[model samples]
Target: RTLTGHESVQPQTSREMLSSGHWLIPTIGGDVWLERPPPPMWWIGIVYTVTGVKASDSIARLAAVLAALPIILLTVGIAKRLFGKGVAVMAGLILATMHEFYSYAINPEADIFLCLIVTAVLALFVSMEFPHVRTTGAVAGSGKPSFFGTRPWPMAGFFLLLGATNWAKGLLFGTVMAAAPIVLYLLGRALQERSFHPLRPYLWCWGWLIAGAAALAWPVAVIGQYPEILQLWQEHYLGRLHRGYLREPWWYYAVQVPYVLLPWTLPALVGLLCSARAAWQHAGRERFICCWALSAPLLLSLADGKHHHYLLHCLGGWAILAAVGLAPLWGWLQDKLRLIPYSAALGAVAMALLAGTGGILWYSRIPGRWGTIVGAVVFISLATWVILTACQQHHLLRAFVGILAPILAAYWLWVPYQASYLDDYKEDLVFLRGAESLIPNDVPVLVQYDWTAPLETFWVLYHMRRPGVLIRDPWQAAEKTANGGQNSSTAYVLARRLDLPLYRRAGTVETVLESTRTRGEKNPDQRRVLYRIHFTQPLPPAPEDYLRVVRRTLW
Candidate 1:
């Protein structure tokens, strides 16, 4: 953290903004710079407003807590339609109370938005079958969703919104999401004689709506902002997708699924295996949903570029399938393992009771934090009751993750306070801010490596500006140091602790900012070590970036 009070750490994107804090507005005659994600997906500004504290605190992540309710209600309703009310409630509760999703959601990340959107899409797909039935007493829709017409407009609208949001996040799940409606429409066509006829006109409408929505939200090609429409489109969407060439193992997402869907939800994988035959024989709505659920993650699984959050939108889809898989296994387990669920519950109850007792002893010392105690008592009592009353049929893993649900709920809520501790690194950020205050605001700054992340996001949004150049290789960094012309400017160096000695001896430099290591994370041998060393000499200003970053953020 390199800012005021160390409440949050500096991510590269946000840091770039800090250098240009003097200019928060883009004037008519000034240069126009399109940021990576204009008004980010997670609404970091909203997060900044709420906690009134920057850096990394649990307090700012209010989005997930508020979103949990809808995720629970919608998933439950879908599960009820597919399984039964009994499993529906359990499924909904399991998801609403899931610790895994909660962990990913509360971080100032885009997954929560994806999580809710995917869940809604999945639930809506399921509702296409039994439109008349109301699971959570929510509004009911027609059996066939009218995405193409007035009736289907809502679903179509949702798809468009979600589709753009997906693209904003590097088009993370774009291919998969785009394929869903096509597949659904295709399958629906095979069954029914006519569906959204005149494929040409229908495609026209689809293209217009999707494109219009994208143009409105995409910062790079903000419609009227530029006259070179096609050129800008290619650069923003197509170019961005190919630029970030970080390679990941192909099987990354597939391998993590077991862990993410842990304990109760893991066995649900069997349902996916069975769904193939089930879909072939039935071709029912459930079958359509089975395809929809797997499509997004399946595509992500195959992509050369991959990240864990890429398939987050599928969490709800996976949960629904997990419900289907578990509902059956839950029954079989009752007879076979008679005592397993109870064993797990007993273990949970004992743990909770012990915790509650511990709370009683510690409450005096930690008075205001009793929300912790109250939360523990409620969930533990609830779990004990479920264990005592959940007559025979229940998935053991489900029951375990379920019992631990309240504990995690308490943890997510309590841990945000510790974001303040996470903010400890912010002092370094403040030092950077202080440095910016001293230097001539108009002077261009050269960042020696690829500097982009949460910090950069903040700096950009706040309208801070600086000419941030990325000198990727050691040779590039070395070159600027070797040529100390008067035209040269300041360059920041990122290097490891061990290399600091070597760099200082070799070059004129100022300011070395080290990042607090992510717990258990160490500097990669290849990743330029994290020290932010400002070089005395800057490389010759390149025509493209020399003045642009500085002009935007400063006078």
Candidate 2:
């Protein structure tokens, strides 16, 4: 926890932590956001407090890790029930092996938590439809067909949490809205056919949870200052949705699926192909699982405005399906080692893969000898581990684990170096940090054309701990320097990319370096949003073409 100036702790990817700092604190002056939205995620803060690792990068990312734990548990539960414990373990491993899931679960982003909560809701609701009272591998209440089987509470609470997740991120709320109602309604029809009163309990519990969670989460600032909160929500969440400035082609999620999901997609897709209507017939829960795996991706694909992260929830459904899909293979193995010859053939193929992968690394002329060697070691070790486990009395669980272990290990080694992929956002962070050291505390930071929230979060987190004037607009920034008799003239800003040449008249606009860590990616070629600058004097009036209409640039 060393700080160059302010007493600050350095966490894993110090720059990324700083980028996210805005979520925790308020430092931007005169901004009208609510003082603090009742932190729906205060538990994250609690985790840091209890573990004393809050100051560490791990603490910042704890929420994601915690969220992923449930998916693992539920996969096991579903696998054990639908197939066997062996399949259940295999399913969980397949999920953990996916680079996308691991990346999200290892970061501070809210997607992993979204994944966890959504998984919980699905598991609980499915369990309620098929209670444990019937342990004979039959979907409980198939003949009776009740939604409210034995456990309704889990489903009830998840609805509340689902809403709370919306409060955390608007996209997740949208996911729930799109998916949950249809699922519930279909389950309700099944319950009706079985002559059971399931819908009432389902509605009562879920309805109360949603309302109660909202009341608990209603921003205190909104109660005390309504206008400010509304405006903030409008500008921040709803406005962004309306504007859709970050819009991507409809196929973006579909395109990213292979890279994001990696090794798991192969097996999971195979699982979907193998799913049996005969096995799942009359099984409402199994039907829902199938629906979940396929529908979420289709919905995301159809979305007009989409982002890569929206599909986090879809991965869990895949894991469970893959587990179920692998169940048959696992079952066949349990009876005999008769499949050994076939598996050994596959093992030989996998060995060739391992050797070829090692050779590629050795020849790539990669920097860092240790990391490269470590990667090669991981690849071979995992392939061998999988082959050995496969050769054992077949545990579908072990089979999946055997295959997945190496992939996960390879990922554990590769992704960190690949983090340069987020170079788009990193350039600005680097520029800001370099500027921070040279620029005086009194200098007003005139932000460029865009709101580089990531860069803004960094400066705010660092500068808030040491209060100073950091203005955003050129006009307002000039005013701070206008009264130079009483106060020292503050440095303003200009963009190198905009190339207005205003800085030449004003004096100087020095460049700063800003680089943030991108998860498991190498430095990328993308442009950063904000470029840090230190102006020696007020920005000259905008060119005649633009200055006339710049009435409210200061705000």
Candidate 3:
């Protein structure tokens, strides 16, 4: 709900709205969100159109979250098919309770949806049979659900979803996420059958995949609507693979694994260790899950631009492996219920409660401390009871009971508090709403920023519900605000503290509003001031601004 919670869009939520808004506009003259492909945004726009609800950040994000439900179901199906009913249950529960999954669910981005599609692809890939070389296509009693007399319908589904995934993000992500597992499965099949001819089914599957991809409307619509899209894709998206904006070291995704998959990272690693042997043995279920999980991130790490959301596609593999690791423990507990002490388990839960409560109280300065503590205590107490009950029952549930407390605590306790603390734009939204009358609708608003932060653009345009532009520097804005009697347009410029001195030196800047964003990881407390800088008398443009623009145009 974070995406839709604010009347004005929040930081990352703004980016979502901007892209989706472009989709809603008519394709003829509409602007496109060029950072990536437009499938996610276009789909969201379709949702808004069908529902007749005002297309807002919340609605767009809700669409993605709803689409994400299948990721869990598909994971369960794949796990049940590969491992067993017990492993499937544990895998589903782990995925359902995961912090990474929950965080992305609320985030109005394509990552979760991509995860869903990728998981579906893996599920289908895992369901196929690698028969001996002689019987590649015409197997009578194979017991597999064949769609095209080539491979199972799930294989076809993989190709269709891969097409959608590509449209949502880009070709590279879709290709790697889909192709790696298929290649690995084929290799494993060939190794197992002792013949290269076993790969014939996969070759036929590729033809089906190509046909399914061609049938998708996104490809036709995108090419028909935006002819220059190829150029934009190259300059904006593909360029990032080698050297473009948001470049990071090769080890970037490697470092992010712990943070992105927090609270589950340890279990996931343990799961990988436990399943390694089975995965290496044959082209069976275990091997498929392992290859599916490891391949995407390894391939993604090769790219120069790394973001946290890209790793979400691997959630299926990670969750299944973790379940593999936890499955033996569950079996052991079931077999020997008398080995563990409930008293010790309860004590650990109590310590966790105290640590959680004490940390929030010590660090949180916001109101509602009492409510947060009470909530934590109650949740922890409930979790402790669950552990005790599961221990008594001697079931697979006890496996979840151990980790459920902390995971739920993060969901119930820390996330709400973090959201409250991280509301850096709350005051600005309120202020904008209150003083809406002071700002005229006709006066164009321009945000002066060196980097792209769609949050500012979203809030300003959303609050004003008017035309706005994000330009590189204050000087560009200063020139835009100039009124030479014949052509006059007053511009509102929002700038951070570092850029404030430049605005001050440039014109008679009247302060509109000032807001401060709290400090957090990798960022200091930042102050931003908005100015109603009218160029009734425009200042001379800086010479460096001209040179910069010339260099950019030339480049």
lDDT of 3: 0.59
The best-first sequence of candidates by TM-score reads: 3, 2, 1
lDDT of 1: 0.48
Per-candidate RMSD, Å: 9.5, 7.3, 6.0
Q: Which prediction has the highest TM-score against the true structure? A: 3
Best-fitting candidate, measured by lDDT?
3
TM-score attained by model 3: 0.75
Per residue, candidate 2 scores C-alpha lDDT tens digits across 138-181 of 33232432333433456546566555545444333544533453
Query: Cα lDDT of all candidates, in order?
Result: 0.48, 0.51, 0.59
- Judging by lDDT, tell me the better candidate of 1 and 2: 2
lDDT measured at residue 476 in model 1 versus the true structure, 0 to 100: 54
Estimate candidate 1's RMSD in Å: 9.5
**Candidate 1 TM-score over all chains jointly:** 0.59
For residue 130, what is the lDDT in candidate 2?
A: 55
In model 1, what is the error at residue 526, expressed in angstroms?
11
Per-residue error for 185 in candidate 1, Å, reads 7.2
